[model samples]
Target chain A: MLCVVNTSAEELRRIALQHFARIGFAGASLNAIAEEAGLSKSSVLYHYSSKEALLAAAVEPAVDRLAEVIEGFTRTGRGAMDDEFVQRFVDLLLSHRLEVHVFINQGQSLADIPAIQRANALIQRLGDAVTDHIPTVRDRIRFGVALGGAAYVLVAAAQWSSEPLDDLDETRAALVDTITTLLADLPVSSAATA
Target chain B: MLCVVNTSAEELRRIALQHFARIGFAGASLNAIAEEAGLSKSSVLYHYSSKEALLAAAVEPAVDRLAEVIEGFTRTGRGAMDDEFVQRFVDLLLSHRLEVHVFINQGQSLADIPAIQRANALIQRLGDAVTDHIPTVRDRIRFGVALGGAAYVLVAAAQWSSEPLDDLDETRAALVDTITTLLADLPVSSAATA
Candidate 1:
């Protein structure tokens, strides 16, 4: 019985995540999520107390993982541009593509939500970790482009494409490679120096 | 008299854009906009027939500029990776930073709005223009990362920073340089090949 109840809650979370990701949190309907999960509205509420609660449940894991990634950066102080760090970051992003989508795109508008606030705070910490070692404004922006760019592209690919990214492995490897390249200490451009 | 009317309309657009960029279209209220502009709601309506119309007016110039940029790409078939093209693209993003923020972040939620639909379509055309020459998914994602990444960073910088980006010239130069480097045909990684 406990196992069945857990499964139902898990199923509701999956359905809710898809809805939250496709539509903004403000736009997604709790009733619709309940209906999609083949449960009554009250039952949905039983599992997650409020719409915000459901949102918190759906996005919390991703937020926690991101926090962990940031913690790793804090510990090492050298992992921001490391290959393993980039790979881990890319994998985390791909794994939580939908949650990351919500965090990136809707974060500002949904700032009042506690889950989103925590997620946003973690993102600020992550930015600091990545940019702390970088000296110049140009270089900091480069890392910003690389990290924020990777997040946006993955979210966009998921949103824009009619089909699932069939070449997931290829896309993942490419993302890691591209981000690492952008973060690498390449020669300063003449235009930038000028 | 004509100049005064035009200025009032222009002022409304400017105020409306800041609100829309900050809170989002659905969240921004016409009454508040009118209050900010020291005009009545009816007077605000006189300038724009509806909220959607106001949104249309606010975003149309940026859309037209992007359309022209894509047209340039289509015309030359060789401008996507060009330095001049990248510069123009970066400038468009910075000059209309708020509008780009709305278009990038709130676009999915506001897709029912005609203005947003038009903007989203133009983005698709722009994506096609940039990626048409690239064969591999990796290369295509690279272009996505560079272009989409740049857009995301600029929008984020504007939103996150308490003060305006003081070194606009340096930031712009770095963006152009980084994007050009990403779009340039560099050697592929072994991981990408595998």
Candidate 2:
């Protein structure tokens, strides 16, 4: 077959992700995104209605991808909500820190848009599914708390990361460790003992 | 002592924080802030140098105060860093989740300002001084990561507290548990032990 370089949607998406990362959602006008994507603005608009719609399409898949990562933990065993899974969840969350930031910051601004809302709703359902998989009643509650803690570690990681802790790698490793330990030592055991 | 129900400074700050919280830094207008604060537009300028300056003054204290709270842990346990001190550190951080939200959300918008820079430098110095007291080298390295994780928990706690986590009290308890556990199980403990 004769060569072709720009017709596929895959190439267009890759171009969009790079531009979006460099210029932020609001700053990256659709004109720029279309130019970067090697497609006519009309062609871009033909597939996605507006700049908001394009931004939503570009990022929401990553959200679904993360939710897919979390959903994998559901098969992690009877204590699907156990310490190991929770800790793994923390790693997954922090590893995708920039993506999480994109979602939290720009996602809300476009949240009322139908596609974005549906994507986030799917993310929520994944969380609920994870919680539902845990067998122990009290452990379920503790897991929920641990889940909350994991989310915090993510958002706060940047500011405190600059502190005099080890280098970035070591610091991230420590963060993961801290969350795992927290899950293992959840007060559930003590509550059961009491 | 005489007490006043409303003062110009207090009113302006209240208005500024609300507006900053609602629309973010680039989006909030000084005139809007003045209107919300119930002061003459000139009065806001009289109290603060510029819009960015006013925003910094309003937000930096919350960050400074957060650092002070974490710094309080040094005062506990024979004036040294210890497990009890870490627990109290977690408590201090979790207690002020909203302030954490304001600081993190507005931080980037105000990132380049002198006041915000000074405040962050102070917080970093405070963190360094605390880490200086630790005997175990690995523990010191991991401390920042652990702390970063704790900060993230506060942000996540705020989001969840809006609905599923219910009121702040329950959220606080949940956060305390998560952080305490994370501190206890730091991964570098293995290195510290070995």
Candidate 3:
């Protein structure tokens, strides 16, 4: 008898992430993912017990990376945290757009999953780290807006723009500067600077 | 022969919006909406040709109100545009949370619908209107962040908060102030004023 391993679990996860992002957690099917991975359904099930397991594996890396980013910020001092954090957070999110897409698409359905829960906690911590420096009620709200805007823009950039986001660095720099301004206590005049 | 018209189309739409927001577009069935509205499925179909039509009818008011808000802002001068625009926009969104929920949940699936397309164009126009005064790329992106943040916070507040959003007015005031801060061009120091 000849034995053959159809597809590795890692490859399944990679393909699953793409499917999840393109469709959604409920929309993505194990058979389609197996076919995309060039593996039989039985072989795919052998690696992961169910679709939920596959989703957990697929989203784990992105969640871990985000947790790491938050952890890295926590180790650093309060000064320049917002600048450094925004730069790193934007970079991470832009590079991992697919991951972010999949995670968001899952929405509330997969909220109870360990990976999703962990990511949420980490994100809450991350939000605190960002908003902690801003003393005023308004600035804190603005901080939330800054974070949401960055995420929304990075994710929806393709839909919003006719062409590729060529000015990514400029966008990142602008996002960092904007967040920094939001973090500050005083409001400056545009006419005064001009 | 007896004729009965138990539920109004407007009431059906109100209930439909709630269902669509709670579940989703595909997840929301006409039968379910009919049941919720205490109308027969045939009656629901009589009022609206299909589920898509019903969904469109439900979201149209919010979209139209948004259009009016943007138009109102255009008539005003540049100086008060940001403040007035943010105030009206925030108020509109906070009140019409269900409409926003249904629109967001549908995502790309209903993008091609005329109502959806019109809403998208109006939103694009809205973005342009808000960002028109900000000359730089960064501020423009910040403008987007402010808008996205406001939408996200309002929608996700129920899930993220343990209690009701009782401090909504304070939050609204803060968001307006934050956008005003982002709209400003100069980097005002935190210590300069204090």
Predicted structure with the largest TM-score when compared to the true one? 1
DockQ of 2: 0.21
Q: Each model's interface RMSD (Å)?
A: 1.9, 5.1, 2.6
Q: Given candidate 2, what's the lDDT at residue B157? A: 34
RMSD of each: 5.0, 6.7, 6.3
TM-score of chain A of 2: 0.53
What is the per-residue lDDT of model 1 for residues A142-189, given as tens digits with 9 covering 90 to 100?
A: 888888899888888766667657888999989987887786673322
Worst 10 residues of 1 chain A by lDDT: A185-194
Off by over 4 Å in 3: A1-23, A27-49, A73-80, A101-106, A126-136, A186-194, B1-15, B29-49, B73-80, B101-107, B127-135, B186-194
Could you tell me the lDDT of residue B116 within candidate 1? 82
TM-score of 1: 0.88
lDDT for A160 (candidate 1): 66
By lDDT rank, best first, the candidates go 1, 3, 2
Which 10-residue window in model 3 chain A sums to the lowest lDDT?
Answer: A185-194
* lDDT minimum window of 10 residues, candidate 2 chain B: B185-194
lDDT of 2 by residue, A117-192 (tens): 6655655665466455544433444554444444544444454555433355664555455445445544332221
Better by TM-score, candidate 2 or 1: 1
Q: Return the TM-score for each candidate structure.
A: 0.88, 0.64, 0.75
| Model 1 stretches with alpha carbons more than 4 Å out | A2-8, A35-43, A186-194, B2-5, B38-42, B186-194
